[model samples]
Target chain A: MEISSKLLEKAVAEMSQLPGIGKRTALRLVLHLLRQPVSQTDSLAQALQELRTRIRHCRECHNISDSDLCEICNSSRRDRSLVCVVEDIRDVMAIENTGHFRGLYHVLGGKISPMEGVGPQDLTIASLVEKVRGGEVRELIFALSATMEGDTTNFYIYRQLEGLPVTLSTIARGVPVGDELEYADEVTLGRSILQRIPFEGSLNR
Target chain B: MEISSKLLEKAVAEMSQLPGIGKRTALRLVLHLLRQPVSQTDSLAQALQELRTRIRHCRECHNISDSDLCEICNSSRRDRSLVCVVEDIRDVMAIENTGHFRGLYHVLGGKISPMEGVGPQDLTIASLVEKVRGGEVRELIFALSATMEGDTTNFYIYRQLEGLPVTLSTIARGVPVGDELEYADEVTLGRSILQRIPFEGSLNR
Candidate 1:
């Protein structure tokens, strides 16, 4: 049934386009918004609009920020010698929430999933190699997933930096197969990061 | 615990401020947004911002609209002489969604409540009275509520239109107590509207 007016219908339709929100849920949300004070709804609208205009991906770390550089990358208090590489910005956030890591981050945008047509060349691996070659960093932490694609991506990066003097290690294999790093609890993720193993040699292996 | 980075924390804080969303729920929503593609997230942000700037409450009917008057009020097909007086704009939407109501609406903003310090003077009761007295209306359907405050507000409006030649009526009282008119299903709500009762003259009885 048409449970909403035309304008409300349009608003709900737009909302339904968002991930995970279906038409009924969208209708409920729109109805809830209609009950709210105009100013309250206005704030939500303002925040969403400003989110894109104000926030950008940090060019250095690829983290979300309101400027070219993210707060983590710009902060001097962080450990410049240590860099944790991740598959997405959400991973950066999950790691940051632990507060034990004091290093910078490098978001790869995604893993090398050959089935999805994602290859090493499509990722930020080249930039990572450049960052390591820049001379200040002493350690490179691979905090990617334990999935097949993640393993493949990890091996590819390991091969690229096999001869570098920098200490190269992965966050660890304790993270379950097919599980994302962002979904691992802080205790598990932290333990995995702390117990990282050195890369055993070549991507061909 | 600092469960998210400062930027993510800030975004979560803002999200939790929305009605019915708590910290955990807000975090989930933020994480979901973080997982989306930059373009999709950007669209959500843009939609939110435009929701406020592009939309405004109709000056006449108080329904949300992109222009001065709501589409319903602007439509030449709707009956201008029949005004459906409602407790809020959501009620207007509820009726409009049925595709049945062909009349304009008058949003009272809220029901009269003494304990909550809300009274007739605090609402749009004066404007409603003025609208009825303008002599262009034939019926004033009070789709208020079945609660004490709703009854009181309806009574107040009925008294205001004491001498007006318009047919004064209260939306059917079968609606459950302390429930919002917006939650009633279209069939029940539509039936309630069709079965509206005349507000018989009685001061205290």
Candidate 2:
């Protein structure tokens, strides 16, 4: 689109750099900012700047935090021996909100995706392996997605800790709870059948 | 979502204020920004700040610009006596891209929407009426949407220019080009048949 003002064009160009946002959406967003009070735009800019300039990642888990050590790492109630490995802080939040998991987290930042040029070294795999070798964590739970990259990352990490004292486990993969069996994909349905647990185990949860 | 970092939560809160962006999408966008280089976020914040602080509206047309007069209003090639009234700069850009209309534009900024508490006084209708009464404009073409608010805005402006020498006209209502007539809505198809133009007139374009 032919924007009249140079400032407007520059704003749109920068806004479109975000994921899933295009030039048209950027224009619409910029126009919306223009229509609102000046303080709204100022606050948004200020908030993003503050977050980037001051945001810190937990030294142990690699999740975003405001301090040197994340709250979960500093907490005493969470089980430090049971570490749940996830992609990033978003996943950390999701698992935390479920109120089911009582373990600490190890954020890999991202999975190993060859297509995106992200290798094992790009994530926090080295730190996780070091933690396991330190003989503190009893079980390392792989809570990543079901994608190929997720499985590859899990296998890569599992290989890094071969013969270690820690026991490695992965989250169950099968049909989701509350979903109709007919709507479930064939692969998931097949996996659910093959990985069927005892009838008492289903009732205990 | 339960964001761990106060800074992250603040950024998401500010980002979610934009239209159509909820907390989840805001978190996703904010996390994407976090994954990129800090310089990208800095540039986006700077561009938005500059756009909101330095953006100006044209004195004559009311379109967003960097100077007192917009490019279309300042251009000598545009027809001064023939004005096309629109809702905002987006409409102006859409019409300008067609390259068919040579007339100048008068941006109303918004339409009359009672549901939103927006009335005639909120727009640039007064200056538009003054321009028409100045005895320079010979024809006033309204290019607003076909919604009820658009019709009310047009009628509101038309009532203000009662007995004025300028001729008033609205853009034609008809089925869109390349659209199958069978799929056209009943109201639009009925209007298109009722306001059918002569066959020779259609051939001229």
Candidate 3:
């Protein structure tokens, strides 16, 4: 589109660089910003700048944090021995919203996707292994997605801690809690049947 | 969702304030920005800040511009006797993209929507009438949307120029160039049939 102003064009270009935002949507956003108070734009810019410049990652979990240690890792109430491994901060937020897990997290940042040139070394796998080898972590939960990349990352991490004292486990794959069995995918349904737990165990949960 | 850091949470909150962006999407975008180089975020922030702080509106047309007069208003090649009235800068961009209209524009800023507490005075209608009274414009073309608010805004502006010498016209309403007849809406299809142009005129365009 032929934008009249260079400043507006530059703003829209930068906005469209974000994932899922196209040129039209970017223009709409920039126009909306123009209509609002300058302070609103200033606040947005300040927040984004501060987030990138001052944001820190937890030394232990590799999650985004303002300090050396993240809130999850710093909290004494959370079970440090039970570490849930996830792909990124979004997963950490999702699991935290569920309010089911009571353990600390190990954010791998991303999976080992060969197609994307992200190998095991690109992730936080080395630090995770070191955490397990440190002997404090009693259980390492693989909470990655069900994609092939997720499985590959899990197996790679598992191999790295073959003789470690920590017990390895993965999130269950099956029909969702409130979903009907008929709607479940064949692979998930078959796996759920093969890995069926005791009736009492299901009832207890 | 429970974010680990206050800085990260603030950024997500600010990002979510944008139109069409939800909390989850905001978190995803924020995380994506966190993963990229700090300079990328800095550039985005800088562009937005400069756009908001330094952007100016054309004194004659009220369109976004870097200077007091917009490029369109400043250009001598554009028709000085014709003016297309539009709802916002987006419409100006859309018309300019067509490369057909060489007339200047008068941006209303927004339609007169009483439901949203917007009135005739809220727009740039007075300046448009003043432009017509100045006697330079020989024709005024209404290029607003087909919505009720658009019609109302057009009528309000038309009423303001009651005794003016300029000829008043609206953009032709008809079926879109490549639209299927069967899928066209009843109102549009009926209007297209009622306001049918001569076959030769349609064929020529």
Give me the candidate number with maximum TM-score: 3
**Interface RMSD of every predicted model, in angstroms:** 4.2, 0.7, 0.7
- CAPRI quality of model 1: incorrect
* Predicted candidate 3, C-alpha RMSD: 1.5
Off by over 4 Å in 2: A201-205, B201-205
RMSD of 2: 1.7
Q: What TM-score against the true fold does each predicted structure earn?
A: 0.65, 0.96, 0.97
Give one digit per residue, the lDDT tens place, for model 2 in A1-205: 7777899999999999998899999999999999999999999999999999999999999999999999999999999899999997889999999888999999998999999999999999999999998898999999999899999999999899999998889888887878899999999999889988877755536
**How do all the candidates rank in terms of lDDT, highest first?**
2, 3, 1
lDDT of 1 by residue, B1-205 (tens): 2542455666677766755667766767766666666666665555554554466777787766777887778989999999998887667757877676888898888898999999788888887788778899998888887678888888888888898899977665455656699988776788778887677877223
Full ranking by TM-score: 3, 2, 1
Among all windows of ten consecutive residues in candidate 1 chain A, which has the lowest summed lDDT?
A: A1-10
- The residue pairs found clashing in candidate 1 are A45-B48, A45-B49, A48-B45
RMSD of 1: 9.4
Number of clashing pairs per prediction, in order: 3, 0, 0
Pull out the clashing pairs in model 2: none
What TM-score does candidate 2 reach? 0.96
Q: Write the per-residue lDDT of candidate 2 for residues B23-125, one digit (tens) a residue.
A: 9999999989997899999999999999999999999999999888988899999999999999999999898888889999999999999999998999999
Q: Which stretches of candidate 3 lie over 4 Å from their true place?
A: A201-205, B201-204
**Sliding window of 10 residues with minimal summed lDDT for model 2 chain A:** A196-205
DockQ of each: 0.14, 0.89, 0.89
